[model samples]
Structures are given as structure tokens and as C-alpha cells.
Target: MLLCDTPNLVSSSEVIAGVSDHDALLAELRVDSRRPTPLPAMLPNWRRAPWPKLNDRLAEEMHAVLQINNLNDAWTAWKTTLVGCVSECVPSRKSRPKRRLLPWLDKKLKKMIKIKDELFAKWQVEKTLESRNLFETARRASQGAVRSRLSLPAPRAFPRRKAKRVENHGERRRQLAIHVLDAKSATGPDDVPAVLLKRCAKTLCPSLAHIFNLSLRACDLPTDWKCAAVTPIPKDGEKSDLRNNRPISVTSLVGKLLEKHVRNQLAGFLDTNKALPDNQHGFRERRSCTTMLLRTLDSWTAAIDKNSGGHVHAIFLDWANAFDKVPHQRLLSKLQHHGIDGAALEWLKNFLVGRSQFVRFGGARSEPCVVSSGVVQGSVLGPLLFNVYVSDLPAVVKTNLVQYADDCTIFREVTSQDDVDELQEDLALIDIWCVNNGMQLNAKKCVAMDLSRARQPRLPQYMIGGAVLEYVSTQRLLGVHIARDLRWNHHVDVQRKKAAQTLGFAARNLRGCTQRVKRMAYLTLVKP
Candidate 1:
């Protein structure tokens, strides 16, 4: 009394029976249950079913019945019928068809389509206008709205061109001879006058001509040649030569300067009247480390906590040209105020203002060129000099801000609109200080986040760039990647791996470490 007569259904049963292993067959059955099989196997009698016509309600009903009954074979059969129906419903391409319309329906559909298109166009235009407005606002804010205060001067009109000076044959020959002589007498390609250099070295030294042309090109040079060329050299020539000769030992000068600066600045703070004990170095080192660590920890905790009940906003500031743009006179005044004097002040001033050369590869060899300001990038004293210059800002703002090198992050709790406004004003003052000190704030890199918004009940988050920035539960820091939700077993596994590595290294080094000692060392090395 079987109603089904599909040959494919019989074949499917035969394929299922061909699997000998029980587990393997069961796995195959699980896969088959989830998805449809090929049409040939699932529906051998698919052609026999009545095909559903275009827009037929019965076609949907038939498909629904197959799906509800979990009949994959029946679904495939119905799909084939549906495809055939669609092919029959499609109008012939060669024949021109007359449009059949109800006047009311035609008018409504046409009106709806027109409205949709108009709305789309309107939306695009509005979006573009909004974006342009935002850009203009940001640009105006960045430029401090100074456009109204300033007026641009009118461009100067060029005078009429003069007639060309056509040289005589004898004059041309004389010029050529002078150029050749200049080239032969030149110490290097750069030594010759640019025009003569180019003419002489056009063929044999094409690069020389190119370089000469580049040098002769109009540029912004000092109006006073004396200021440009007559730079002061060291009065103590012997000491200058010694400093140049022993660059590595230059740290002695840095240390002596640092010691003097510290003494001068901390004279009032320190009990100068009392005799100072030895071991100041150890005491200073420990104090500095402890202070820095405590400050860092406080910042990290404040940044993480969201619902410990505070309206916290953190702003990070970056200064553009922090070292190079420092005004020489201003810096000297500040140093003098701190009691730095005599030879030390002179040396420091010279070090800050001295020009230095950097060599960059230009294909075959390194080409050397001088820069006007800033500590030389790879020089030993660069970081020390930079740190010294920027040391004042943090000291002044220590009560309100935390600073590490160039990065200063300001934190404040705001519970009301007034508080927020006040915080913004405070940040503006900081910005002004930076500007006055020849630094600039990088507004884009700065983040101002509200910590009150969190998706989870117990989780803390900060709003950054319109998204919640949660503390990373798992992250890599200083090469070690820590796992989130660390368990006892996982910790044990980590320790075991680390122990094996340590033991291997020890063995290679011909050192002894027992298994127990190795495990202890591993635990010590990797704290969590």
C-alpha cells in the first residue's frame, strides 16, 4: 500500500545499507538529515507531478507541506515542478507584449516609485550637506577661528617679459671655456657655481647637473647672510675637541648637569641646613620607582572602573615638535631660574641649539645633510635633552594629570553639565600652556570618554569613538599573551611548558636544576 514510486528513494535506501560500520553509517545519516541530496537520487519521479504555474498559491502550499513533514525527497520534487512552471510562465522574448493596466493601480504604483526615487535623492543630498558642515566646523575649530581677524593681501601682478639676450659666438665660446675650467678646479661636484657646474657636467656627470639645478632653485633663505654663515664655535677649543673625540663618555657631562639641576630645584624641598647622609643614589632610585609605580597603578584603576560611581573623563595630549620648537631664550631663562649657571649653562645652550648632520642612502652611497633644530635622532644625549626640556609640565600639573614621557593623560570626575564644562576649560588651559611653550596638541589622537555606559551589569566600560571600550580580558603586553578566564589546570599546563623550556636551556648551558626547583622558577617567572 506504498504511495511513493520514486526509483531514487529506493536507491537512497540501498546507499544507506552499503555502509558496514555502525558508527560511520550513523555519522553519514546525521549529515544527510541536515541537508538535501542530489535531485536524481531524491526525486526520480519529479516530472510526474503537476507543475505549479506563475504566481500560483498552490505552489507555496505544496512547498510548505514538504518542509513541515521533513520530506527532503518531496521538497526536491516540488522544486523541479516550480522551476518548470516558471519557464512556462516566462514571456517569449521575440514577441512584443501589450501592457495590461488598471488606471487607478497604474497611477498609484507610478506615484509610489516617483516618491521613493525623490526621497532617495533628498536623503543623499542631506547626508552630503551634514558631512560638509561637520568638516567645516572641525576645520574652523582647529584654526582657532582666526579667519575673521586676518585679511589676505592681494597677489602681485607679474611685469611684461623682456626680450632674450642672444649671446655672440665668441661670448658663448668664452662661457663654455670658463665652465670647463670651473669643473676641473672644483673640489667636488657641489663646490662649483650652480650654473657653470650644470653646463660643464651635463654629459659625464648628469647627476651633478641635476643636483646643481636643485640647489639653484628658489628657496626660503635668511635675509641676513651674517646670521646664516657666522655661527659661534666653542671658546674652549681643546675641550670641544675632547667632547667630540669621546662621545661615549659624554654621559659624564649629562650626569653632572642633571645633578646640579636637581640640587638647585630641590634645595628648598630638601633639609639643606642638616648634613646629608651618603647612599642618596639608592634612596632616590627607590623613591622614583615607587612614586612612578603608584601613579601608574592609580591611572590604570581609574580608567577601568565604570560604576565605582564617578563621571570620569580621560584626555591624552600629544605635542607637535616638542623638542625642536623649544625657544632658546625661554629655555635659558627657565634653567637660570633653577640656578643652572656658568660653563654648564653655556654647554647646555650650545647642545640644544647646535646643528647636526644625518646621512641617508641615495642609491650608491650615504648623502649627508644638516638639520637646524632638535636633538639628533640616534645621538646618546637626545633622549636626556628631550626629557630635561619637558620635565616642567608634569611637575606643574602633577596634582591633576599623569604624564609618562610625551603622553599626558588628564582624568576628572564629572557628575553634572557644569563639571563637564569646567573639565573642558581646564583642558583648554593645558592646551594654551602647550602652545605658549612651542608645543601643539594633537586633537585627533586625544580621547575624551565617559565611563558610565556599560552593556553588562557588573562590567565597566569607556565610551571611545561612539563605542564601548572595555578592558581587555585577554591581551599581549611586552610579548607575553595572557589568557582570559585562567583556570587551575591551564595554569599548571603553562608552568609545565615553561619548566621544560628552562630545563632545556639550563642543560644547554651545563647548569643544574632539579625538577622541583625548575617548577618553582617557572612559577616565579610567569606570575599569572
Candidate 2:
């Protein structure tokens, strides 16, 4: 019984220490196999003794008999006596009263009786084993077999490969070669190589020259490049003349204003406190600048009038791996052509070097560690540097192209099919520019649509191939969510009705209260 309850017993040290005393009693009962000779020869009177008190002796005796090593011996002794009891207690139908008299005896009944006898014999054997001195030994051996079968092997581990020293050396050499090439190419304004300028035109302003100025500034070009030394000759009778070769200084009042406005708009997003170094060891300051530039371009585009019949054509360009694939020599030449000078150029060169580090989590006592690529997103100067490199393309193509980061949009005044064809040619040039700068045009995202159709009261929808382009009205941009069937005015009317009902209910309730108050005042006066 104690062995049966052993699983439930909680020990101060371990939960299941050993078997219970009930098991010992069962084992002893099975071991005592001697029986009374016959019923007539039995003692005149037989009485049951009081239960034995539990003590250290009983525990010692049980421990000796139930040793795990002697399990088989104990089990065999218990089974012998158990089998004898089954043979005597179970009845044999062959020796039963005549079945002809009762007429109910059959083979099925005999089979059932035999089955019962067999079951009884098995139970008696189990009970005898349970009462044996080696019961605990038997139980432990059985449990051990089960545990051995269920046990799993410890997992094998593979050794990690050490980073190759030769690989690091090669990478360093490649980086050094790039740096040397960039330095050698960095010369004067005209020194900006044709290839670099062409790339910049493609990347910075494939549609308009105005964006070139922004890209130059974003790139941190030298002071000289910030100003346009040559001015454009105005059209006949236009506001400005072509002969004016005065240098347009970025430090000038208008230039400063533009810079200030762009910075001010970006201030909300530029969190200096959170800025960290990126994987390339550069800070990400350009994201804010890019955002500001895009917003400014959007605003400028929206200001164009549709009623004047001035059609706008825009294309957004996306460069694949813009930062990673930047040709250092080409970029340097572009910077030189733009007028980037000594110290600024040197600082940029140093900024390109990559650095790495490891990171850990959890606490001092129990911590987990992991190795990963260094910070690449939250760096303070990372965005600015990236924007500088990316802006070069738009700057050179600014004659007709408008670029806000990778998003390029070309606008043209279209009247006829000839005009559309001309715009397409210009767009093709823009695509070529992108290809030159290691950028690819994703044709799926690129769209060319007519603003005239878009401006209609109920605009006729257009599709590129089979895919419908979303037509957004200027009015819809002003916080109005437009659906196919629902109009803004209809929503406003519903809101207005709801508001009026709410006001009417309040007024009615107030009127009732006011009348009651007046009546009370009159009653008080009359009572007085």
C-alpha cells in the first residue's frame, strides 16, 4: 500500500524517494504459500490478528526483500502460489451437476467459465507478485526498462568555421583601390568627368534642372558648386536675359531661405538624440531631407493649373541597390564638377569605411548574445550621405527632369499625339540616364496618364494595358476619401443632418426647462 501511495508522497528533498509499506505487505502475503490441510482438520476457531504497527524493522525487512537485483526471484515465487489458488477456486464444468436436468449448459457457458478462471489466475499472480518482498525491485526494474526505451540521446553539435583572413585582406584592398581612384578623379568643376555628370543627370533630375540644385546641396558639394555660374537665356521677351553670367551663390538670401525652409520642414523628423552609426559607419541624415524634397516637389506639381491646358507628364524612377552599387570614382568626379573642395571631400572618403560590432541582451546574471550587421537606419549622417550620392543623377538631368530622391516625374505641355510622342522620347532618355547610374526602371510602377481626363467632372477612366490607373482629383487630396459611388458632399450632408437633429433635441429640452423655471418664478411671486 505504501508503495502504491509512494507516487503521491512528497519528500522534503525529492518527491518520489521509495516504495510504500502496502507493497511490502502484499509481497509478504504472496510469499507465504502454505495452506490448511483440509476443512475438517482446521483449528476449531480462527481469529484475525490486529494490524501490525509500522516501524523501522518493517521498513528494513521490506528494503532487504525488495532489492532491485533480486526482482526476478521474487516475481517467480509469487506467481507459483498465485497459480495454485486459481486452480482450486475456479470451477470446471466437466465436474458440474448434470446439464440434461437443467438443459441450459452449453459450450459458450463453458468457454466463459474458462475465460473467468484464466483472468482470475492472472489477477492472483499479479496480487502474489505485489505481496512479495521483491515487489519494489520488480517495480523499479520494470520502470527502468520503460525509461531506457524512452530515453533520448544528447544532440550532436557542429563546430563553427572561423572567418577567413584572406577574405578580409581582399576586401580591404578593394576598398582602398576605390578610395584611391575617387581621390585621383576629384579635381575642378570642369574636371567633373562626362560619365559622372551624365550619371548625375540621370539620377538627380532626369526631367528638370531645378532639382539639380537640391541634389548638389544634399550631396554636401563644395561651396562653389552650390551656385550656378552660368544663367539661362530667357525666351524672346521673357523676364530674364541669357548674357548674365553672375554666379548664383547658395549662401545668398534666396538660397538660404530655400535651405532654411527645407530644414525647418525636416526638423520634425530629425531626432538627433536617436541618431547612431550605420553598418557603413555613416549617419542617416538624408531621410528627412529626402522627405522634405519630395513634399516640396509634390506641392510644386499640384500648383500647376489644369484649366490652362498645360498637361503634365511625370515618371517616378527607382534605383536598384542605389547606395551599395554607387561607383566611387564616378561620384567623386561629379562632386568635383559640382565644386566640392579639399576637407569636405576627405571627410566623405573617411565616412565610407565600414565598421562592425556585436550586441547582447538580457541581464548580467543570465544574458544572451547575438551578432548582427551594424546599425544602418538610425545613423545621423547616413541619409544625408546617401541622398548626396543619389541626388547627382537628378542634378545633371534637371534641364527638363524633376527628381525627388528615386521618384522621378517628367512634365510636359501636351496638345496632340505628336506632343505625347515627344514626351515619350524624353522619358526614354530619362530611362537611359537611370540605366547609366546602375538604376533600373520598374515599368509596372511607372505610369503616364492624361491630366485633362482627370480634371473632368466625371472623368473617363484610363487603363495602362489592362490595369486601371487610379485617378485622383485635386479636391480629393484635401482630406476627402473618395469612393466609386460616394461623394464628399453626400457625406457632409449626412453629417449636417445628424448635427441638426442633435441641436434640435437639446433646444427642445432646454425650452421645457425654461418654461418650468418661469412657472416656478410666477408661483413664488403669487405666493408672496
Candidate 3:
């Protein structure tokens, strides 16, 4: 008999109830939070030693501490000494005051802010109408004062009338125009301004086309071009912690333009050559998470239709820093395997090698450090390179693998216990592949789910690196809620909540705004 009919799988409601009880138990064991959480301790701005000075000190210390010629050991020593020097120069301040966001905030505004704070404190102590009214008045005055100081023009008082939302041909054209303008204005992190990009693209495309047709090309890059500026952005958790941040590169406008052309050529060539598997959907033509989901559902349905009474078990695999961890040499080998060589390959190698980056946040910029690995983030070619890097993963693993860029789901239909063993074997094989490819599986975030309509489903426990994977009743695959029973009620409920939140934001911000603006917000934000 299939595991789904084995009377072991718990119902959704039962799972929810159990989760609630578990949460209650955790809350009881944890400390009560009667007071507000304190802000993170941060170093003073003045104490932040200049990057050049830190680098000099770091070099001296690394030379003194490290005797080994081993590259890995040398790197470890360098990082350790660098951290020490940084800490010595810029020590943490536990009681440091919060940094003000507004630079132009004057003494008058500060006084008003203090008054408002006092009023709030009083209201917190004693809830009275007079205190509340005073607080509201002070808040409005302080805000108005700030706006007035900034020389912001006051809105013209027009007679209030509800604008009709009735759509016509003219309105449709106007809305389309608004969308076009908005998209044009919304440049990404590494993108040049729309005007500059248009001018460059127009002038460069024809020459670029000619270059693509050339049989031989030199590996020389422009010497005058500045290296990309690297900025550290918080991945998650406390921003004050250096470990929480990852480097993002901002390259030159011309570099981005050239990369855009390369990306287009590479994507076309790969698609035409059928180098990417049909299961690989991300960054590929006419493929998406939606299509992947539909195909997965169809496959499972077909299995059921075969009268095999099999259960579909899926493992959503996550990689730790997938793009950043790709081995450059291996990537080059893969590109060559896919018939990319000569000028194209050499240009890509130039793009990848000897790249330096500096950490920039706010006004403070660090000294440049050489980046040994990873494709440049925020570049047009980054995703394409990553796709090509992991394109052959399907051949490495035995099971049905569905990939959306780095997001992968391995699924197999199981009837007997022997089939469950096969699924585990496939996971082991994938682990070996990841090991060889210089990537690590984030076993904690990985989850296993059994998809079945049967009342009870029993599936084998999967492990990666000796860590047993968590079994989930519902798993979110590419922003879509997927459950064992394939019911969409949970997904719909989540989307409805998100839509309501967006609608509330529009109601607050676009209340007195133009009807067209409101419509644009509705269409782009709420509708999606």
C-alpha cells in the first residue's frame, strides 16, 4: 500500500494545533519581554579608523602571525588580523545614541521633538483626553515646522470632489503612459539613468553586433575604466554586525551596457543549443515558476491516473550563498563544455577575474579588497552566468529536478518503501554534486513534503550532512503555498492579506492624490 493510505500523516488542523501548543511551550520556557527590546550596540563614527590605515596595520599583523605558505591558512590569518585591527580601531559602544536620519534638523525642530516626546511619556503614564490632545497638536506642529523649514510648497486648496474611476480609451492610454514612465524611471542598482542608457545602447549595439560576428578577439580591457564600487548590504538580522552583510558591486554604465548585450547573446545561444535542461526554468525563455508548478501538478496527477496509488514526495533544496559560492574555474569549464570560447569566453574571463571591491555604506567607504570568487551582483550577466553554472545539475542527480535559477525542487513518486530509498539516494547524489561544485546545502532550511489526497501519508525521513530534514505539511515553493492535499485556500488567504496591506498603504498615501496615480498603484501593487 502507498504511504498516504498508511494512517500516519496528520491533518492540517491537527498540525496547526500542535504548532500552537509547541509555541506555547516555547513561550513558557523563554524570558518574558515586559520591556522594549534595546537597540544594537554600534561603534562611534569617529572611532571608525580609515580603511587605508587599517589595511597597513592588517598587512603587518598578518606577516607577523602567519608562517604557513598554505593559501587557505594565509587567508585565515589575514581575515583574523584584519578583524582584530578593525576592533582595536573601532570598538563597540553599547550605550551609543541612535543616529538621526534627518541632517537638516535644527535646534527649533529638536526642541519641538523633545516636547512631543515628553507629551507621549506623560500620556503613557496617565491616559487622559488633555494629554492625548496635547500630544496630537505637538506632533502636527513639529511635522509642519520640519516641512516649512525644508521650503516644501503647500498643496493648493481645491474644492474636494470624488474622481470617477470609469475607464475610457483616453484613460487607458493615460494609464499606459504612466506605467511606461514609471518603468523608465525605476532604474535598478547598477543601471545607468534611462536617458544615458538609451544614448549608449543606440550608439553601441551596431558595433557590438559586428564584434559578436568576429572570429578572433583580444583579451585586453580598458585600463582607464574604474573598478566597480562594492557596497555591503545587510542579508538579515542586526545591521551593526558585519557577518550579516554581503557585498554588492556597482559597475560602470558602459560595463553594464556591454554586459546586457553579452547576456542577450549568451541566453539566445544557450536556448538554441538546448544546453539547459527543459526542467530548468529561471532566466530561460517562456519558462517560469508558475509553469514549473503546473507541470509538477500534471506529473503527479498523471501518476495517480496510472492507478499506481503512489505519493509524490518533494524536497525543496536550498544552497548557502549559491551565486557567491560558485567556483570560477569550474564555471569556465562548464562554459567551454557548452561551446563558449574565443572572444566571448575571453571577455567573460576578463569580466570575472581580478575584480576588486570596497565596502560602502552611508558616508563611510572602506579600502578596496580583492574579491577571489563569485560573479558580480547587480549585473545583467550575473544570473545568466549562474544559470549556465548550474545547468548540468539534472545530469548529476537521478530524480526529477525542477530548477528556477538557484531554487531547486527534487521530486519523486513513491509506492513502496524501495522507492523512498531511491529518493534518499538521489538526495545523497545531489549532496555529492554540491560538494564537488563548491556549494553547501543549507540543511536547516531544506524541507520535505509529501503531496497526497489520502487521509494519511507516511514518507521516509531525508537527511543531508547527517541532519534530518524537517517534514512540513505545507511548503512555499517560489511564493506559492503548496500543501499535501494541493488545496489553494492557504495560498489565496496569504495573497489576500498581502493585497489588503497594499490597499491600506494606497488609502493612506494616495488618499488626496490623482485618480490616475491611484489606478497605477492599484494595478501595479494590489492587483499583483
What lDDT score belongs to each candidate, Candidate 1 first?
0.40, 0.37, 0.68
**lDDT of each residue in 1-528, candidate 3, tens digit only:** 123331323222222235444522111122234543344555433334454554455545655433544433433443355446657764455554356565447788999999999999998888999999999999999988875654533233343655545365633433322322222443332333343224223232333223322312444333212256666767856444577788676664434544655687799999899988899888766888789889987886776556535578889999988988888888999999999988778878877777666655554557877767876676778888998898888997777999998899998888888878988998998899899999999999999988877767776788887889989998888888887777788889999999999999878865544566567668777998
**Judged by TM-score, which candidate is best?**
3
TM-score of model 2 relative to the true fold?
A: 0.29
TM-score of 3: 0.61
Q: How close is every model to the real structure, measured as TM-score?
A: 0.34, 0.29, 0.61
Model 2 backbone overlap count:
48
Q: Any runs in candidate 3 off by more than 4 Å, and if so which?
A: 1-194, 197-216, 223-226, 232-248, 304-309, 508-521
Model 2 alpha-carbon drift over 4 Å, by segment? 1-310, 319-325, 355-377, 390-400, 453-528
- After superposition on all C-alphas, the RMSD of every candidate to the true structure, in Å, is 38.2, 38.1, 15.5
Ranking by lDDT: 3, 1, 2
Judged by whole-model lDDT over C-alpha atoms, candidate 1 comes out at: 0.40
What's the CA RMSD of model 2 in angstroms? 38.1
Better of 1 and 2 by lDDT: 1
* Backbone clash numbers for all candidates listed: 0, 48, 1
State the lDDT at 426 in candidate 1: 62
Q: Where does candidate 1 stray beyond 4 Å?
A: 1-293, 299-307, 360-365, 376-381, 394-399, 451-528
